[model samples]
Target: MNGIAVAGLSQNNQSESDIQKLLKGEILLETKPYSAWGGAVTARMYLPLERSQVWQQVTDYSRWVQYFPALSRSEVLHRGDGQSKGAKRLYQVASKAFLMFTAQVEIYLKVFESIHQKTGHQIQFSLERGSFTDFSANLNLQDFKTGTLLTYSVQATPTVLVPSLLIQEAMRLDLPSNLQKMRQVLCGYFR
Candidate 1:
């Protein structure tokens, strides 16, 4: 479906039960064709924490490998100069997945983060050098009553000859686990 339709579905499905399910480690993930050759993965959940707390957890690059099982390394290569909202920061990440043996991929990304003082926070990142031919993503956090609603969307095209189906399968299997881990770690801070 289209982006608007997917967003509408997500909003409609955001019930109290859904929020409870997410807090209990359930994650909602969906995929769609963003381009003829590339696809998009959208993961959404209601987090039982303030927006600031959620933002902190996501932007803390040094601790990503600790919470995200697939990530073997997360390092900040360069810090933003703070000239503008679009100030650039560079990061390197190594991720691995095991089907029979381990398959590892390392990526370098340039990220720009922006905060809307009245609304929410956003982080947009694009691949500078990676296994993927093209990769871009955004994390958006919005206030949801007492908690926060987090939505992460990524679009990617593999540089290698990997089937799109395999990519989608990997995303479906991995995104929820990553989100669940993030939720658990962020929740611990409050308790």
Candidate 2:
């Protein structure tokens, strides 16, 4: 489906019962392909843990490599303090193996973290310098019943020449696995 049509599917429109059902044992993931290129994806995942615990894992910049295994490196470039509050810069390298060829993508990101309203913690990030012409993402953690509901949304366009369909297809297939792996990692921490 085209980006505009698919982008119409967003968390804002989903009913409470619908989302709760989707949060069963797997992530609720959706992806859309842009006409020019690249794609956007949004996911809602339920973690059987407190929101604070989930927030700790995400904010610990260095540990992102664990969340996304394709990442070969993730490090803090600069950390904001005092007046800057939660501002930070992060550099990451991701290597993907396709057949016999390995492709590497490097990104420098400007990140910010804050409490959203009075209920949830949110992390927002955008590209500073990267292999992508444009990249931005948001991660939100909120309390849901006895556990945490984590939502991730991202839109990215790579600098490399690749078809929009191919990019969106890959996102559709890979994102769920990545998120499931993340859930496993988070749950493992308590066990």
Off by over 4 Å in 2: 1-13, 82-85, 98-100
Error (Å) of candidate 1 at residue 47 is: 1.5
Q: For every model in order, what is the number of clashing pairs?
A: 0, 0
Please list the C-alpha lDDT of all candidates, in the order they appear. 0.73, 0.79
For residue 125, model 1's alpha carbon misses the true position, in angstroms, by 0.8
lDDT per residue for candidate 1 within 49-109, as digits (tens), equals: 9898888878888788867787777887877675744556555556565455555677888
Per-residue CA lDDT of model 2 for 1-191, tens digit only, reads 21112223455465665555545655676777765778888877778898888888889889888889998899998898877676899999998774456779999998999876456999999899989989999998877768887888888888876778777777776677787788889899978
Q: Which pairs, if any, clash in model 2?
A: none
TM-score of candidate 2 versus the correct structure, residues matched by position = 0.87
